[model samples]
Target: MTVATTDLDRLKSGADQLFSKKKLAGFSIPLVIIAYLVYIFFAFDVPGLYSRADMDNARTLVADSYSYKMHVTRDNRSAEVDISIEGRRNGTYPEDGSPDWVTRGEETVIDLGQGHIATFGPEIVTYTIPGYGTFRAEPGRSGVNATFPDGDLPGWINASKNRVAITTEAGRFTVTRNRTEVFRYFNGWEAFWFTLDSPYYGLSVGEVAGRAVQGEAGDIFTAFWTNSMWRHQDVAWALFETVLMAFLGTFGAGLIALPLAFLAAKNFAPLMAVRFAMRRMFDFLRGVDALIWTIILARAFGPGPLTGALAILVTDTGTFGKIFSEALENVDKAPIEGVQSTGASAIQRYRFGVIPQVVPVLISQLLYFLESNTRSATVIGAITGGGIGLLLTQAIITQQDWEKVTYFIVLIVLMVMAMDWISGILRRRLISGDGTGH
Candidate 1:
């Protein structure tokens, strides 16, 4: 080796030493800055959290129940129904089959067999049967048959059109027929639940109930939370939209960032001066927080996934450009020189020698940016008025407690973790270092 030593070897060794020192110096400030930022970000909490009233509000929002009101409408229809009273053991239609009515102690039967809740409106006649304390609302339908003993007929019940009023002895309720209406009892909305849901004003449930079930939406639950409460389908759909926003935002940004990176690379750029300018521009772009970008985009385009995506795209361009250019700069000049000595064109030199060396770095950087962007997307979605974060903000503002707040937080965390794991795997396989991604 002492006999064969050459000038090229010395130049290469000196360049490596210089590179190592410069790299170490460059990383120092970034590492310190990152450490400080992570510390502050983790420890920070909303100022509103300190107030007792705010804490109580948050708790109330999260602790709320789940109930919903559905609007139903129908045209005029009536069918006579039979009312009956019998013990659990055995029963038969009474002999005479007259409209037998009963009181708390009495029993009655009618020609029309037992009816459903549809018949159980306030106008419908009903009275206690001897053994069963449960009130029954039989929808009024004409020409049905059953028999009963005598008492005062209650009134014409029509639960179909009014707020259902049903009373019954819990232990003993069964239908002789597999009547669908009878099954309705099992499916009927609970009275307590009615107070928890949002009901729209134009619907009969709200009109009869006095106040809209939810407010602002002008539905029932708004009033009810004002008074106990609960709330998922619509929420889930909105959440789904938020996830979509993140996906599109990240994907679109990656498309633009990839090419800009090559141009920003000092090894690939047409001129050294141009490369320097582009590198500085990239630094400026990435230095600006994604959230700030989102705000700017939202103002330019209005609230939408486009703003979120543009923010990611704009930010990622800076990030990828820096990474790609660094990778280009660090490339082995020996291979490039070998290609050039062969009289290869500039493009051909890069294609054969430079690209192969940097491909791994490009892939690793791409994966890293994609992973980072997912978390950024969530944050941008929140502040820029798109994605699950928007609704999450509402939940926080409304002071819903642990459950509602936990719901979105859990989703976001899981998504970020999944992204990190995937990126790590890709980076390990593609990048030169023996890092976790492998």
Candidate 2:
């Protein structure tokens, strides 16, 4: 009875210890998570970030991405009034021509749509907002002489001694010592395909198609492709460079990695030292991120598509070597033995036997990486100043051409999607041995 009671007491003690551990783990995990969250909150300055965040600027940026603005600027010194899309000289209206909403004269009047109207006189600029009274300013050498309605100045109008800016739903108007300008926001990208000089600028799609059928296609296409404002030709060439960079880098890595992989594979490399050295080389290559490699290569090769391609090659060669080596290690030995039984040479054994077993994996990984690298090349191109990414970066830096940024982003997405589809189809066809010899 004493022995049995002692055993029961030990069992109870063991159960109690296990329950205590479980309880400690349950409480400790939540406490650790809470502590980590608290640390991160302070470390990243979450409160300051929230305070600094400007929703108004965010909204304006988002709006600019989808819409365009037309600028009607009057040079106060030159006394010259010019109407242009996004204030670009290439998108400027001819001296004899003006938009229906604008009437240029000694005093230029811009209809900002709705009831809002902006008039730029020789010395004075006036903006009239509906429901609100007219806001007036005279820009001169001294300052912007301004007057508001009887009531206090509204928040929408920003006024100072030297400059006065008015903003409303209809448009924006500003006056300074050097220039008086009005910006009217509009939907859709302006002068995307054809600029103001092109005869097909205002034509409907159906009309353009009709003209294309009527043999004016070449003229229309030339006008669009050579457009100075949008630079469709430049964008097309940049896109081609981006694809070429990715293609050259990915395939180059594959070609180079295939042989190097054998040196890293334990089964193929008889000397352990050779395998270790080759594997370490691969690790060194892939260890540095592609962007870091891009920076290094750009300094050496100068900024170009070739530099971007080389960066991708160096990074991917290492990754492919590691992956290919592992795949080679796991390959079935039956085919290799079968090939050897035929009195095949060593190279022939590898080619006819081992390669066949791992080819599917190699091809699959290559295609997947090809698709992934296409996206990476865009960013790489920006650094190298060679591809569509360069154009995108330029647009973003300008701050005035968010539409162009959107266009580039959309093109990138489409390019990536196309590459993904192509790679998928190839992966299916090659890996499954569909419509191909075993």
Candidate 3:
């Protein structure tokens, strides 16, 4: 009876210890998480990051992605007036041509929408704001001599000895020693479908379609496709190159991996040394990320689409090797033995029995990787300077052409979506060996 009572007491003690451990673990987990979060908050300098963030610049960048601006610039020395979109030479207006908002004569008068007006005269530039009255500046060798209205200077105007700038809801104006310029913001991307040189520049959608129906479709398409500002043709070609890079890399890796997988698979490789070496080789290849390989190869082979493709191939070969070897290892032995029973050669057995069983997995993995590699190729092309990523990089580097950045991003998203759809269809059809996706 004493032994039985002692055992019961020991069991109760053990249960109490177990319950204590469970309670301690539950409390300790939450405490540890809280401590780690506090460490991260300080380590990342979250307060400093928040303090450094600029909301105005963020708003401007976001606005630029969807809208474009027109520049009306007057050379102070040459007395030459030029109007252009985004101040680009290719988007400049012809000498005699001007938007309806501007009147050219002895003085070039610009209507900056609303009640804001800016006029360029022989020696001075004047801006008239309905509620704020008029402001004037004479830019010359001395400086931008400026005059302001009564009361204190408004926060919207920035003035100095050499430069003066004014910003309003309607537009922005600036005067410097060399030039006086005004920027008028618009809602959409101008010259997207047709540039100023095109005959259909200002035509409505219905008008363009009517012109196409009248047998000018070829001319219309040519104008849009050859657009100097957007370069739709060049972009389309770059996209094609990106997809080609992915295709060549993915399929090339599959081809190289399939043979090596045999050496890595234990059932196929009689010697353990060969399997170890092949498996290690695969690990070394796939262990390094593709971007790292891209940088290394770019230095070796120089930069191009081929370099990007090779990088993808090298990294994917290792991955494919590991995956294919596992698949080969998991293959059913029944079919292989059946093929051997027929007195088939080793190669014939592998071809007829092993190949048929693993084909579905091979095709499925290859197609999925092909799709994933399409997106990877874009980033790889940026380093190699061969695909849409190059154009996207260039646009982002400009710091002013956010609309082009938007266009490139949209194209990339569409390309990825199309690849996903194609790969899904192929994965189903190839696995089922039928046209209808199962």
Candidate 4:
């Protein structure tokens, strides 16, 4: 049945009022609800996720890790003990690592007020209490007390940095880390500062204290000191190789994608039919991850740095094609129209009107891509036997040596940070038109 004109008008008027407020209200309720839900999702969790035992152990671990001996005291009882350590096991502590394998955990409660003298041959330890004076023993000795001058014990707790040192009759011996004990002279165990406030034994201390120094010659401390284990030549060549790979890959990809991005963008392309298809093609290439491409490339090309860098180039081309075309589409049309009004050729119009406007953007994108691709190169290096990463993978597998891994990782991190800084400077220069005229 046909509705009356008045009824139809009433129905339309009610519908408009309902939609005007409800349209925005529909979105508002969900927004507020979702925001509240998200807040709940992150703000709370299962109770006591970290067990009491874990916290106790972690505190013990941290205290022990820093060489601080922990003392427990309450209700007329006191116990002091050391915690276990964390680090690459280079055997730096005199405790378990030494030539005689002798860790002389020598502790003495001495009064600086009393005088006592002690002496040993070349490998003896001697300390004098102020008034009590001197006493001596062989390389290995236990608690031998000097007569207290009306005193129960001395005040200072003479704790070795980690182990006891053997001194000569003259009360002094050189602390050296040399094979064969150099019994000719003694070198004190080495202790080096880790942070501003505290110090820990250096690798040499572990080497010498363990008496393992005799078995292993030279200084472990010196070894850990250098920036790169590689000779200067290898470093120079490897650096050249990395820079060249990035340049060649980025240059090749840019050349291939610049035109593709133009054709893919509707603003420049007359064929709207092809534009959507090309845009989808661009998306397809960009969808595949870089590391995934690296794996495929490594398999097909045989693993190498070139294969790794090329993988980055292949992946980046698709991503940049999409980015470049969008940049192209977003270009100011005033210049393009002005050029067209003069009846300029297509190539000339693009060269004069489009490229100049977008060159800075393109360069910015390229530089950003370069920075991104460097990390990709390193990951690829891990998979494909390239750069320091390949060496790192090998080192980890061969020795299970976390220290060496730490060493390589530090280098990689520093390199990445340096590259980022360089890229940021170049990007700023390009955008601000301050780059040396290219």
lDDT of each: 0.53, 0.90, 0.93, 0.55
Give per-residue CA lDDT, model 2, range 168-221, as digits (tens).
899889889889999999999888889999999988999999999999999999
Residue 188 local lDDT, model 1: 26
Choose 1 or 3, whichever is better by lDDT: 3
Candidate ranking under lDDT, highest first, comes to 3, 2, 4, 1
TM-score of 2: 0.89
Score residue 423 of candidate 4 by CA lDDT: 89
lDDT per residue for candidate 4 within 1-438, as digits (tens), equals: 356887988899999989988988999999999999877776764244545347665543343333321111111111111111221222223233332212223432222212332222234334554445443322222322222235443433322322323333222221112101111112221122121112223334564546434543334333323213222234335444555566667777888899888888878898987898888887777788777887788788897768877877787788888988999889999987898889999997887788888888888889877776666666677787777667667766754334345556766777778778898999897778733223
Candidate 4: minimum summed lDDT over ten consecutive residues — where?
A: 70-79
Q: List TM-score per model, in order.
A: 0.47, 0.89, 0.92, 0.51
Instruction: Identify the superior model by lDDT, candidate 2 or candidate 4.
Output: 2
- Note each model's CA RMSD in angstroms: 18.6, 3.0, 2.7, 13.5
- What is candidate 1's TM-score against the reference? 0.47
What lDDT does candidate 2 reach at residue 331? 85
Model 3, residue pairs in steric clash: none
